[model samples]
Target: MHLGQLAQITIYPVKSSAGLNLTQTQIEPRGLRFDRRWMIVAAATGHFLSARETPQLLQLLVQPSEQGLHLQAPGLDLQVATPAPDGQRQVSVWDDELSARLADSETNNRLSDWLGQAVQLVYMAPENQRAIDPRYATAAAQSVSFADGYPILLLSAASLSELNRRLLEKGRGALSMARFRPNLVVDTALAAHAEDAWKRIQIGAAEFAVVKPCVRCVLTTIDPDTLQREPDNEPLKTLIEYRRSPKGVTFGMNLIPLNQAELALGMSVVRLA
Candidate 1:
C-alpha cells in the first residue's frame, strides 16, 4: 500500500468564517471540536448564510474561547456563548432544515449591525442532528455538524500542485489550498485526484471513509485574503474545462471519521480499504 503523511489540519469553528490551522486536532464524528458548530442564519427566513452570498462573511475572523468562539471584524468583536442556546430555531442549509440553538440577542444584534443586515448567530445543539447523504456513508445512520454535509474534507498536496500547474499554464497565478478549506491535507506520492478512488484511509489511529468529491462552488472563487471574487471568473472557469461533473465541479474529497483520535501533522495516512 502506498503511504502518505497528514501534512496539515484545519477547523472552521464557525461555518463560512475563516479556518484555523492546527498542528494537532481532535477527530470526532461531529468533526473537530467547534468545527462548524456555529453558523450565521438569516433571521427572517431562518435560512443559513454563507460566504457564497455574503463574501464579506469571509472577513469574519474566529478565535476559540472556553465560553465559545470570539468573532472579530474590522472594528467589531463579540464573544459567543459556548453552551447551546435554550431557544431553538429551525435553520435550513442545503436540503436539510436542522434544529439549531439561537445565540443571545446581543451577540446576534452586534453581528447583524456589523454585517449591516438582519441576521442571527445560531449553534447546532448536540441533540439536533443532520444525517450525511446515505448513499456515500458506511454507517446506517451517520450525522454531521453544521458543515455542508460531511464531517471532514480531505485534499492532497499533489492535487493542488496539478491544479496550480494548469492555472499557471493559462497565465493565471497559482491558488492557495485555503480556497478549498480542507480539514486534512495529505502529502502523498499519488497521482492528482487519487483520493477520488480511496474508499477509506487511516490517519493516526483514526479511520476515515473517503465518501464523495466535494462539489466546488462560487465561494471558492472568493480570495480568502481579499474576500473578493476573481474578476475573471478564474479557477472556476478553468475548472469547468476539466473538473465538471453532473453533480458539479469537484475539487476535493469529503471524509467521515469512524472513531475518535488525535491527529497531528506528519502522521501517516495509510489506505485501509
Candidate 2:
C-alpha cells in the first residue's frame, strides 16, 4: 500500500469546547499531554460534563499553558495554575469520584455566572485515578482524566468525505471537521475500516499502535456549535445503522504512541503495516 498523510490533528484541552487545531501533534499513551487533562464537574452531583450537556461551557475558552491554563470567559481573564488550588472537592468522571481542586473563587464565579448555574471547575489531579472501561480488556486499567471514554479518538479524512458526499446529496451543509473530536485524523484513501488494518502506524518519527476502535456515544449527537442535542445527525445516525460494534456503533481509531516525543504539525506519516 502507498503512504498516508497526516490529514488533521486536534487537541481539546477541555473536552467539548472549540479544539486547538494543529498541523501535527504527538501521540502518547495517556493522549496528548495537557489534553483533556482537566475538567469541570457538577459540584453537587460530581458528574463530569462538557458543553454538549451544558452549552454554557462554550462561553468559557480554555487554552493550555506550561503554567496551567489561561481561561477567558464573558468578563474574566484568569490563569489557573497546574497544581491548581489545594482545597479538595469531590468530582466524578462518568462514575469515578475523585479528589480535585477548584480553579479559584473569582474564576468559579465567572464560570457559574456564564453557565447560569452553580458549578465548580475540577482539575484532574496527578493523584486522581480513572480507569478505562473494563470491557476493553486491553485498555482497561489504563488511566484517563477529563476524557469522555476512551483515551483517543481517530478519524480519517476519507470517512469525513464520505459523510460529506451524503450530506451534499441531501443538499445539507457540509459538516465541520471538528464534530468528531479526533486526536489524530489520517488521510486514509482506503475504504471504510481501513484504519482497522493498522495495527501499528508511524506519524513523522513517532510510532503508534491501534488500541481499539473508538466507540460512539451521545456526545456525537450533540452539536458542537449550538451545543444543542440533536440525536438525528445523519452520519451519527448512519453510524448506528452500519458500524455498530458490540460495544456500540464505533468510529475512528484509538491509538497509543510507541515513543515519548511530541508530534508537530506538517509532519509526514507512513503506515507501518
Q: Write the per-residue lDDT of candidate 2 for residues 86-162, one digit (tens) a residue.
A: 67778777666667766777766766776777777777766776776666535445766577766667788877777
Q: lDDT tens string, model 1, 78-175?
A: 78886555799899988999888888899989988988899998888778889988887788778898899899999999999998999999899999
Reference-based lDDT, each prediction: 0.87, 0.70
> Candidate 1: what lDDT?
0.87
Best by TM-score, which number? 1
